[model samples]
Target: MSDDVVAPVATAAPATHEPPARDITDGGPDMVQFLDADGQPVALNEVNSPYAEYVDAIDDEQLRSLYRDLVLVRRVDAEGHALQRQGELGLWPSLLGQEAAQVGAGRAMRPQDYAFPGYREHGVAWCKGVDPINLLGMFRGVNHGGWDSNENNFHLYTIVIGNQMLHASGYAMGVQKDGMVGTGDPERDTAVMAFTGDGGTAQGDYNESLVFASVAHSPVVFFVQNNHWAISEPNDRQFTIPPYQRARGFGIPGVRVDGNDVLASLAVTQGALDRARSGGGPTLIEAFTYRMGAHTTSDDPTKYRIAAEVDIWKKKDPIDRLRKHLESKGLADQEWLEALDAEADELALRIRTACQQMPNPPHSEMFEKVYAEPHPLVEREREEFLAYQASFEEED
Candidate 1:
């Protein structure tokens, strides 16, 4: 009777959707590194690194600012990792090895510029004045989003891969309509930057964004942080060509940066942002960097990525190179370094407290921001939730 009543056995599990093919030359091999593994700036044009005439506009003060930002941002990232390990948070995406890439791109942004970030862009969030606790809650399982997208001129952390690129494009379209481009007045000029990864480049959202940005001449920058691996998938799995070449196909200029070299990243980002602000069309900046840690605290890279790959990236550690640059300039005295360490410790403690204090959202909270106006469906669901919660037996 059971055999007769049973549903037919499935022949195969649903076929898995394969990821997009990898590009062997989408972005140039290795990366466009300016400062070598040692952190000293290399001779321009000697390596594959290209120069923007605009780079000449930068000064030492700006370079130091980039350094400070990278240091603090990395500290914030590490603090987040520690919080995850301590069980104060559920998960944390490490910016462990991409500080220079974030700081350089962030510092290049004007106050009027807007940024769209993926979930992993905490370093960029820090650059936009977001409190690190905001990032903590998402991983802590305490809340969906910690900040308002409009709050810091930064959009909410988009969890869907490459989705923000489209949002950023839409925002850039709005900017174009508002006449933000070619305003000439620095105070009135505006540009948009969207951050994603190598894996995201395969998403149609990324390609679609390029199309919109190019056709609209939208003042936007597609910042691709090619951290070498998209969770379990290696860079090779994402593209057959390097990602930067995709930008050229979109009819926009593209640049590659030694994401580990703060100076170079700074130089390139500044140039790109400036170009966009001044009515130059969109550019895609492939920050050639590495993800030194797991994709998230929940990931285990050793399963798909080899130890040698990570070791190779270790030589290009962004923070180390920046520290070297700072030391060369006599800026990293023991006192200064100690003070930074102490500050990081204090910041870590604060993050721990905040994470621990993050309370569980109320049952009604789920219905809070789904719509601009009251929604009958949400109201019904919230009522049902409340009634369901009340059904629980008395607590001890």
Candidate 2:
């Protein structure tokens, strides 16, 4: 990644009377982290020991692939943000510093498992085989969702905050009833994963979904990418305690992982998904990461946050950490890394061209999907709309 694309850590602003927000840079002792900010491996301790086996089992090829994923996903975010700025897209929610949190959890899922994502899970969508162009259509105002949800076992991006949790819980209950859990068959057993943000934890739907999943013993994983700020609100405004620590109240096992550490994120999420698939019920995974960009293209972080905080997280960039690990371990060479960079350039161009070429949906399309069967009211509205459009054409 270029230095220009990465936001620089600025000097801290003059202190104010308001109390300073909690320093969440270090995810506390309980946070599972395999790779430190400098890309050095940390000594395995009781907190992270259980998840270490999963990371240890990863082959060299898999490690290189993880690096590739982190790079490509970041490129995707960069391109999307650029497109929004260039007016090709109406808006974009950047995954920025949260690449490892999304990709690690995303790669852990099997083909049969389903995912319910919030609007910003572009990294997860990429891992689930959705074309980057498909993701742009919604932002471009061309379609409600550009891909089939069932085709990839990835649901459409839910714009409503925390709503997918309820959807995922209900689907998990159905999967349980269908006898798809604990079948002793790897291919048949299925798990559901719901993605949300730190702010989502405050929503009533999020709590309700936990209740439903707990009572039903549903095979689901609630993956919360706690990126510190909930839009303009800091973590202090959202909760009294970290999300992972609060999961116990719901009778679900919760684990906090260093969201910037791809290996740790993958290992912890894999463990949780494995447990759920085996009918162990639901688990909550709090990926302790940071959002390096604005909440969306429409948001301006400078108005609400300090550049110092962004700089702290920037040192812990997921892509940089993985790249360092690959270099130090001899998993990827300079030539291969350069080629991957070239590949990212190609990907960016492809998506940019695709976005520019996307045709706007017909004006009449708004009325097309209102009902499965044609309704008299809808037909009348369509006729009126067409007449209105025709009147404009006559004047032109």
lDDT of each structure?
Answer: 0.77, 0.89
Kindly list the per-residue Cα lDDT of model 2 for residues 72-133, writing each as its tens digit. 99998999999999999999999999999999999999999999999999989988999999
List per-candidate RMSD values in Å: 10.2, 6.0
Q: Each model's TM-score, in the order given?
A: 0.88, 0.94
Error of 2 at 226 (Å): 0.7
- Judged by whole-model lDDT over C-alpha atoms, candidate 2 comes out at 0.89
Error of 1 at 367 (Å): 1.7
For candidate 1, lDDT tens digit of each residue in 1-396? Answer: 011222211111112213223321222333455667777866656434444443555566665666667777887888888878987787788988888888878877888899999988887888888888888887776676777778789888888999999999999989988988898899999999999988899999989999999999989999999887788776556776566655667888776677787767777887788889888989999887888899999999777755655666687788788778778878777897788778777887888788888889876788887999999999999999887877784441
Q: Distance (Å) between predicted and true CA of 241, model 1? A: 1.1
Q: Ten residues in a row with the worst lDDT in model 1?
A: 5-14
Candidate 2 ranges beyond 4 A from true positions: 1-23
